[model samples]
Target: MTTIALSQEQQLALSNLCTNIQLWAKELGFQQIGISDADLSSETERLQQWLGKGYHGSMQWLEDRKKMRLNPELLHPGTRRIISVRMDYLPEGSQQIAILKSPEKAYVSRYALGRDYHKLMRKRLALIAEKIKQDAQAFIPELEISSRPFVDSAPVLERPIAEKAGLGWIGKHTLIINQHAGSWFFLGEIYTSLPLPVTEVITENKCGDCEACLKVCPTAAFPRPYELDARRCISYLTIENKGEIPEEFRTVMGNRVFGCDDCQAICPWNKYAKPTCEADFQPRHGLENSDLLTLFMWDEQTFLKNTEGSAIRRIGYELWQRNLAVGLGNAPANPDIVSALTSRLPQASELVAKHIQWALVQQKNPNRKRVRKLSRTRV
Candidate 1:
């Protein structure tokens, strides 16, 4: 990576600009902001090994853009620093485990309970980028602060970058966990050419002997501490797989219709997790407390209406119905659930029909058990 030769006076100006940037970020509703030099060399091998093992499942894009993830300069030319920001997204009154334990209710991941975060975070990051461009012109009139903002839309190693930026250490679940903020937040990044001083990596790997996150995964997604085998991860199976929910994991999937949160919910540090102040992050359409059968009954038009601005809309109506069918199957056998599953089968695509058939069999068996391993310890 080429280093920009900035004058000593310009360096001082960059440092001062960072201070104002943080204040501006907080005003824009981001909980925290940290800056890191654009060097992800430390994570290159680990990322390669994870992808080599095919742990990313069918997410081939991770491997497709291998070089870009390791080199920030490749993402935005002349990039020298990355500004990583986090926003708490855990909705207030989140009955995460309660909904999971209820068998009959759908347990959408807390992050997806509200409107999609991409637009919100991207808009905020773009504001900061514009602010930097305007502010830097005062110091160096010719300064070209080439910049780009990313929110899960890129192949960037968000957790590693956030950890380097002093935001948090990556917990056992591979999610960034701040000592003070837990893991219930969203991450956004601004790749730029500014020579900003890197934020000190103060947060240590406090996950130390505690493996509660690993133990709580119903499908045993963690092959080892600090490593996630996405193939077995419920989040990947339900959201990213875009195919069949393996039979082995379907029974253990419980009532999680969209994405799973067992790892985050069971983390002891999450006790420190705060509810989000952003109304946009709050649950909408009664999604936080909805029943599996109720959600499964939604026709395509209703599904589109309810998930209008929500993150759940990306999976399309087919996968949404597919996941809900699995949740209904894990739900206790009820004539209502049975009827819902039966009603959707004839109209369901072959992919969804298979899950509906699998669900019908579960509904027919009165002896079926949910066998959920995780319990609600936080509430």
Candidate 2:
């Protein structure tokens, strides 16, 4: 460790600065903020092993930027510390659970129900970075401070960084979890050149003896704790992976038309999750409880307009329709649903048509159960 002599006055000032950062973080809608050093060799090896098992499916990019993901300095030269922050995204009450069990309503992941988090999180991080700069200039003028905000946009090992920063430990489901905040939060980071004090009290893994997330997988995505088979994950199937929907996992998908939250929902730790106070995070376009066929009927223009600022927009209208077709197919069949699928059949692309035809067949035989159990628990 490089020892930089600090007078008692400066030491006290730095302590107060940390306190101020936490308070400002809360004021800016962040649930928590923690600082960590920039070493992630172990995490890099784990990632390589996971990728080696071909768990990433069509997401080959995960294998591309190894160095940047493992070291913040690779992404931003001179980066010496990472400032991680969390923001809770779960909507109030049991809306997500209720929808998941319904089998008729479309279960969009709670995180995607609001405005796109990337922009919102980056905006807040910018403000926080500005605050830190202003304070540091006044108190620690010798520090060559440089900070940049990031939210799921680069090759940052966010979960590992969060763990080192004392935000939480990586759960079996591969999501970061805090004892106080649970796993219902979005993580962002600020890569800073300043050698900030690291949060020492790292969260100890509490997934002991319990594999609720592994057993709850609708597609058996978890090969083991802290390891995920992305090919079997609903979020990957519905959002990231393009092309045909695999037949084996379709029936278990139920009415989840977008991202899935089965693993997070089943984690017992989430009971302590706090609902977000930010109005920007609340559900929009009635997506929290919309029916499968309802969302399925959105025209291309309407889909674009409604999802203008939402993360769902990144999937494009074609995939949106494709996913909705699958959800409608899995829903309890009815004349209305059949008619809707039939009408769209002529207009859909080959990919959408394939899913639409599948939906029509499902409508023809509503009670036809094909592989009813996706997994023992994780759905």
Candidate 3:
């Protein structure tokens, strides 16, 4: 642990500052906050093993930053403690399962149903860091404070840090699950030089024998408990992998056009999840319940306009069309859907054209039940 000599008065004031940080976090709309020493030696091997197995798929950045990800001090010089904060982003009326069940309707991950969370959370993290810096100036003038904020960016291993900070336990599905908040939240971190006391309350794993999350995955992305094979993950196939999605997984992809949330939706722990009041996270462009055909008909201009401030925008129009074509293939056969697929085929990029061809075949073959990766009938 990194330590700095502190006067008795400075130690007392620093302890009080920790309490004040949590209060400031709440005011800035964070649901919870915790602190942890920047040591992740135990996770190094697990991360290495996952990468060695090629589970990260085409995300080469994860490999390039392997060294920095394992060492917190190297990622951010002078870092001594990590401040982890959680923000609930599950919006009310998302109707996740309802949309998933309706093959004709698109099922966007609840997280992307609204504005991208990266900017909002990053700004809040910076505010907290600033507040700490100002407080430190008053309490310990002799010692300078240095801090950096991150929200799903850089090489930081946020989940492990969050776990150590007592924000939650990493569940079998490889997501942080809090007994009170469940798993429907975003994580942000601030690497600070402060030697504030680390969080004392470590959450215990409560996932137990429940395998609902694993069994519900449309693509069987989880190889085992606490392990993910990103190549087969619907979220990865739809958002990260720029090439054609593997043919085998397309049938079961269902209507999850942008990202998948089947695992989280089926987890028992999420019964405790709360809705966010933040307007930025509420459903925009009527995306929470739009039809597959409607989204497929959008021109590139319309697609860009509707997704202006959304996380879905990152995937771009071509990927959006490709994913929607897959969803159309899984939908109950319809002539209008067939016509839309045919009309777009001529204009689609080669990557999207192949998916359109596949959708046409599925639409024409109304008699056969599509093969699914999982036994669940919803697929």
Candidate 4:
């Protein structure tokens, strides 16, 4: 292989090369691309505070590798610049409000309905990294340093890096949201030795006075505008937290079987959000607007087969059933829904059985309409 010791002229050429790379990235489905230095001290402090509050719940991995998450060089030896890219992932016509309003229907967050984003984003980032490698090879017969691509796999503080790279500012909901593209995007990072010039300006916070995301949370998961209590979060209860979901959150959970999107769905800026061009992100198995009992009836084999490449598969079949059971409990009482609950109760795990029993009680009381209100206490 050829090695290039970049001189003044070569450095200038590399800068121009980076601009071309951004253009190419845009062509290949990235909405925006930015470069930034790997300083994440501010984000590290915020993480520490959030963890100190016990908001991370059982996700002890956040406590591990304190330094590595804040420093890119700790993860990748020669990392100098981080190339951050955003690809919008919102699927079109995912009637969120209608599903949330309908107590009988389940509401899986749009992102999880399709294929898992980790593999898809990593593939694209790898392709981008490969292009950089080829460009370097042509310029300097031997560019010894290599580029490594990352999706949410490592200690990489993706949002802060993206913020510095001018992708978007972290909203009160703690999601990075572009002014034009909104918050419906997947982020990817490429750690490289190549010293790309950092983006001149970071995005200014556009979340001024708008606590819409904070107020719209079904579980009141936010401690304040910027902080989140993950234990109380429905997304955490339904997906990340392995054991039984706390009793308090079940009723308010409504029909959200997988992840909750109440915050994003209510965000006024999301009107600007663009639909994804990637067919991989399109909803599968009619999950975007499925009935609670319909999804609750899927056996383990059917669950595994249907959610083969989906992000929802990570929660496993039991938790899937557990979450759907909660959704079923919150659904308005019906004989069909009751029969479905009764059928699953015998086969369910203790965690799922508890929720099924709750559903049965709800089923027996045919007159009560389950109101959509979150539990005040953290699960």
Candidate 5:
């Protein structure tokens, strides 16, 4: 962590490099890029408070990486600045609300419908880092450059860093929301030792007086305006939780089999969300508008092959089936759905079998009401 002294001319050159980095990032398909100092002291107390609340659920990794998350230098020594970038992920013709209202259909989170963003983003960030390294070396040939690229794979406090980088502000739902781009985007970062000039203009939080995201949450995950109770979050239950989904959340989970998007979907700013130009993010395997029964019928091999390179693959077949079972249960009961759930009961894992049994009960009970209110036709 030794400080490298630079002359005034060298500092000006480094600042100019920052401008070139932004242009290079755009060439690499990033929608926006900004620079921020690697000081996260402002967020340390907030992280501790969130962890103290035990809101992280079974994700023990968050706790394990708390120190590094708050201090980038601890995670990557010599890190002096962070290059934050955002890439739009929303696909065109996303039938988000349509699929949600159609109980028979499965509502995979839009972000997971395509290839996993980690690899794509990481590769792009690495290239950006390499370009920066080359440029910095050209500016100061004797200067040693150190940089690391990160997607969601690392315990990086990306949302807060992006905010400080002037990318966007953390919305009420705890996701970064750009005034123009909304929240349908993925964030990536490059931790670098180079003395790049940081962005001075921090994006202001524009979510004033709008509680639409909080109210639309099926699980009421937000206990307040800015805090989230991950234990009660449908996204965490469906994607991160390794065991059975709690009975309380099962019925209200609706047809969202992968991750929930109610908060972002209801946010008014999303009207400005432009469709992603990246082909890698386009929905694959018809997952954007798939049926619960259709996905439920995917055997382990089929599931693996279909979800290859996709984010949904990480959940594995058991959780995949388990999530679809919950979705099917919330669906309007159909003879086909009932038969499908009953047939899978014998082969299902102990965890999935229990969910299938619960789904069977829900399918048979005619008095059960759909938890989701159908109105909008897109997210």
Candidate 6:
């Protein structure tokens, strides 16, 4: 697409529109919003290096979309700027450390405790995009405008975009961390044709000398600062990996049945993390602090009903059961857990059956020890 030079009047109107969009975004429940130029040349080398290291594991899509991810214009034609927004997702009264310490409790990732964010975020972003289109049309008639909203559903490099838009700096754990807001939030973007003035101020990396996130990982998923080997990551092991739970990481997996939050929880900046006010993000079905056996006992129908409209539903019942079995194995072996595992063994698929049997062995073995100490729990 050819770039059209905007007159002074058109430039002023676009600047005002950008300002209005921020206010509108706030009204739409976004805590922060920023505009960034579409150029992602700086991130290309880093992304290539990360992909080359085989850090993405089974997530081959990340490698597949390398070209589009580097060039926003390719992903969405006529895109000149990216409007980045952040929505805090940490629910109030989260017992992250408490539930993590209690081996009997099933520790679902705080993000998955509530309804899925994709639909909600996409709807909100689309609304913002429409409002932008309306305002742009009103300002300059016949000015071509095109925008596309993206949550995590697309190949968008949301964090890098957010960072360029002055949202936050990328921390050692590779998550965007605001100095004040921390990292307990979700990011979304609207790729737009409008040449809005980009955010001039970029937040510098504030994670100086703090290797807490790296050291606190149960599976030591981080090989170095700003690098993650997702294959060994608990979140990947529990949620992304389709087959059996790898035996190597199970002992250290603890009670986290869905996803792990150790890196975010251990970040010192999270002390300032704000709890989300959105009802959609609040925990559903008492998942905030459920017991291992209670979740493990959930039949396919029960799992389906409970996880409806929740991110956990994407994993399906088999992977859900497989993860719970690992959690049960990590729990202080009780007869109830043993019974739950034993009863499910016959009906489980070959993949899930292996995990169930592993749980049984863990339940029966009195000498099997937890790899990590429980005293490090913090939120």
lDDT of 4: 0.85
Which segments of model 4 are wrong by more than 4 Å? 1-6, 140-143, 366-369, 375-379
Estimated TM-score for each candidate: 0.96, 0.95, 0.97, 0.95, 0.97, 0.97
Candidate 4 — which pairs collide?
2-141, 2-142, 2-143, 3-142
The TM-score measured for candidate 1 stands at 0.96
List the global CA lDDT of all models: 0.89, 0.86, 0.90, 0.85, 0.90, 0.90
Across 1-379, the per-residue lDDT of candidate 1 in tens digits comes to 4445778999899889999999999999999999998889989889989999889989999999989999988888899889999999999889887887798989899999889999999999999999998899888776566789999999798999999899999888899999898999999999988778888767789998999888888888887878888988888988898899989788888888888888889899999999999999999999999988888888899999999889999999999999999988888768888887888888899999999999999989988766765332311
Pairs in steric clash, model 1: none
Worst lDDT window (10 residues) for model 2? 370-379
Model 5 segments beyond 4 Å from truth?
A: 373-379
lDDT of 5 at 113: 84
Global CA lDDT computed for model 3: 0.90
RMSD to the native, candidate 2?
2.2
Tens-digit lDDT string for candidate 5 (1-379): 6777888988998988888887898898999998999999999999999999999999999999999999999889899999999999999999788887887889989999889999999998999899889888986877789999999988899999999999889999999999999999999999999888889885889999999998888887888888988998889999999999999888888888999999999899999999999898999999988888999999999999999999999999999999999988888879999999999999889999999999999999989876554222221
TM-score of 6: 0.97
- Per-residue C-alpha lDDT of model 6 across residues 240-292, encoded as one tens digit per residue: 88877778788889998889999999999999999999999999999998998
RMSD of each: 3.0, 2.2, 2.1, 2.5, 3.1, 2.7
Tell me which residue pairs clash in candidate 6. Answer: none
Alpha carbon lDDT of residue 204, candidate 2?
A: 88
Residue 232 lDDT, candidate 5, scale 0-100: 87
Give the per-residue lDDT digits (tens) of candidate 2, residues 77-179.
8787899999988878647878988877999999998899999999889998898888888977877778999999898889889998999898888899898
Residue 221 lDDT in candidate 2: 82
Tens-digit lDDT string for candidate 3 (29-65): 9999999998899999999999999999999999999
Q: Candidate 1 regions off by >4 Å? A: 1-5, 373-379
